[model samples]
Target chain A: QQQVKQSPQSLIVQKGGISIINCAYENTAFDYFPWYQQFPGKGPALLIAIRPDVSEKKEGRFTISFNKSAKQFSLHIMDSQPGDSATYFCAPYRDNAGNMLTFGGGTRLMVKP
Target chain B: NAGVTQTPKFRVLKTGQSMTLLCAQDMNHEYMYWYRQDPGMGLRLIHYSVGEGTTAKGEVPDGYNVSRLKKQNFLLGLESAAPSQTSVYFCASRSNREGQGALGRANVLTFGAGSRLTVL
Candidate 1:
């Protein structure tokens, strides 16, 4: 049913520019949102996460802006680098049935130098 | 700590073949998970274990089975391999902490490199 939907199947941004990925969820039960970055041949790694209580959370150059009413969240990476070129996934946490996570399709980002 | 590690990083099987994937964690985590990643589909949970001797099914559990006989190891078995079963498998583990307020919450999952499987 696609509980979480992400936009821009692929993104290309210039180095030092801002890279943003957005996601929206249909379930209000979701309280936690996390972003993951995955390199080829590797599993996804936690990048940043935010709870619905906060409208925004920033970690170093990475930031997560969340809107509870809209059920949307976005990840912003400042000063995007070529090394940042990889696949990004946004996932929402809904622990109803069990400790299960619902993930978005994915966004492939390319930061060109 | 070697964190979470999956055995047989790569495997190839034919239809009707059966195999088991082993996942071991050195961190003594209470929760372990098995997920599969496809081309367009992101990571989909197949099975998970909250503790030793307890296992639960995830989003896609058909044609698959899992066991957690020991706290440090989680095994996933495919009774019959099919072409649709081809994907990259990942194992993750997390520990419980206070203020997380529940089991398997507020903890980041440490994932393994991944295991690539091909079914002919």
Candidate 2:
């Protein structure tokens, strides 16, 4: 995809471990970077979001770290548990005339208890 | 609040068949989008509507078409389904009620549960 490049197609983590997924984009016009979480047979839901102006944003146990100059952003999940196992995707949005979203391939994370 | 609802949770179609996916939102969002999710390819945009009576192509709009006759409804139609078109379809809506209005950082997207379709 020409939009964003995501890493680690699949990841396995022990209970209470940390899960990390990284995504990089080439479009400087992208202003909103958000991560979506999807469980089996479910639609992807917004997990966290960040604006280009902020370097990092943390909510609950999820944190989004953005590097504007590097055009990269990553999602970090702390104290990951089995219930946290799900697929994560990085989608960046550009609000020009309308909202245009480009998503990464996705990362499937399995947290084993 | 029934943020977004997609009809037909699952469907199976033979090659050359046709189907339509419906997405309805109660949030009164101005922007609605249809995306197909395939393995490895992730989620690819099929079509989008900025507002009622407006539709635009996305990255993978070649195999699909869309219509937004009402502010809360967006419809996706597959004229002739192909085997390669088998994938999970998602509908999303965002209220552009954030930031400078034109370019807002708070454009939050709410996604539908999803509609699974198979074209064999």
Candidate 3:
């Protein structure tokens, strides 16, 4: 079963525009949500994360909005730049087993200059 | 610290062949993971290790075997190469912790560059 589902296989946005990616999960046991950014030929790095206890969490230009009832979460990037172009993955953590993570399909975002 | 690293950045294998992918982490992490990435399937967990000498199956563990002989090393072996197993593989490690803001909560996964395998 696919625990987490992400939409928009690929996306393009103009520079300085807002970029949004959505994700949904079926497992309600997950409490922690995190987003990762990956560049070509490199590993993915932590971008932003949020706990279900909070409705939203923002860090600089990156924001993660969570809806516990809907079992969905989203990542929004404000004032996106070309440098922000990369693959983004949304992952949820299940506490049942050694804090294992369930990752989404992933979304590739491209910011046009 | 080198964090997490994988050997054989790129490899080509023939059907029925056998090979092993090595992953090493120097951070003394308690949790280790192996994931495979495909075009649209995203990253699927093949196997994982909670600690040294412990291994567990994940989402797609078929035709794959893993070993965590040493705390710093994790190995993934394919007994018989198949075209379906051709994909990019990643290794991750995280420290152990408890409660909120703990050391490792699955939010931060230090991954390697990834090993690209091709089976023909």
Q: Which number leads on DockQ? A: 3
TM-score of chain B of each: 0.93, 0.93, 0.93
Name the regions of candidate 3 deviating beyond 4 angstroms: A95-100, B102-107
By lDDT, the best candidate is: 2
Please identify model 1 stretches exceeding 4 Å from their true place: A94-98, B99-105
Off by over 4 Å in 2: A95-99, B100-105
Q: Listing candidates in order, what is each one's chain A TM-score?
A: 0.93, 0.94, 0.93
Arranged by lDDT with the best first, the candidates are 2, 3, 1
Per-candidate fnat, comma-separated: 0.46, 0.46, 0.41
**Reference-based TM-score of each model:** 0.90, 0.92, 0.92
Candidate 3, A54: how far from true, in Å?
Answer: 1.8
Give the Å shift of residue A19 in candidate 1: 1.5
**Cα lDDT tens digits for candidate 1, A12-104:** 999999999999999887766889899999989988887777788888888999989888999998999999999999988743333766578
The residue-by-residue lDDT of candidate 3 on B4-114, one tens digit each, is: 999989999999999999999998888899999988778889999988999988999999999999999999999999999999999987766543543234426789999
